[model samples]
Target: MTIIQFPTAPALNASEPHDLLLETLRAATNQLSQAGKALVQCDSEPAARVEAASHLVSAGQSIVAALNAYQRGLQHASDQAAG
Candidate 1:
């Protein structure tokens, strides 16, 4: 099994919403990387491997979208606080 190393950030309280979101994104990215490695090393039947690969791709895309949205939200909140 391949182990993917994910960077660890300082723990934050729930009240730190932006930090919490960032941490969640980091964890998700690490999980996605691990899934990709597993798919590459998979020795299952061709059809099952293909299906798992497809699901991983879909999940990765979703994570990217969610990360983008979270960043936008953080920016908006910062702007609001400034203005």
Candidate 2:
């Protein structure tokens, strides 16, 4: 089992939506990585592999959504700062 080390999370301030989005992105990425690892370890069992593949697909979708949300949050912050 490979442990992924993520950088220290920013302090959560209720006023900062970016911090929350960043945390969501990190968590979704970690989940996706774990799902990929699980699929790799499914061995020769076709049923198990299929189940793992399903989980991987779900994780992939989650990461994509998280990334999009984070990107939008950053853009919003930039716009606010530019005002």
Candidate 3:
């Protein structure tokens, strides 16, 4: 019999769950912001410009998802605490 093993991600040392989630959302927002600015300022070829634009769109979508998920998580936790 072969024993199966899975690798575990490193544990975080965040003092608060909300803080960690908020930080993740903030970082995602920052990434989108920088990508937008880069798209505006970058004077590269048309292909490169399109690539940057695509990256901005992707990052923005990811940020929205992150925020939505974080909000839902907060609501669930809050409800659990209240009840």
The TM-score of candidate 1 is: 0.51
Which stretches of candidate 3 lie above 4 Å from their native place? 1-17
TM-score of 2: 0.57
Each prediction's RMSD to truth: 5.9, 6.4, 11.1
Across 3-44, the per-residue lDDT of candidate 3 in tens digits comes to 212122234345555766666566656666666666666565
Clashing pairs in 3: none
Question: 21, model 3: CA deviation in Å?
Answer: 3.4
Clashing pairs in 1: none
Report the C-alpha lDDT of model 2 over 7-79, residue by residue, as the tens digit.
Answer: 3324445345566666666665666676567667666667666666666666567567756876887898799
> Can you give the lDDT of residue 82 in candidate 3?
100
Give the alpha carbon lDDT tens digit for every residue of 10-36 in model 1. 354544546666666665566567566
- Which prediction has more favorable TM-score, 1 or 3? 3
Judging by TM-score against the true structure, name the best candidate.
3
Model 2 clashing residue pairs (backbone): none
Write down the worst ten-residue block by lDDT for model 1.
1-10
lDDT of each: 0.61, 0.62, 0.60
Who is ahead in lDDT, 2 or 3?
Answer: 2
Please give the ranking of all candidate structures by lDDT, highest first, separated by commas.
2, 1, 3
Which residue ranges in model 2 land beyond 4 Å of their true spot?
1-18
- Candidate 1 local accuracy as lDDT? 0.61
Q: Please identify model 1 stretches exceeding 4 Å from their true place.
A: 1-44
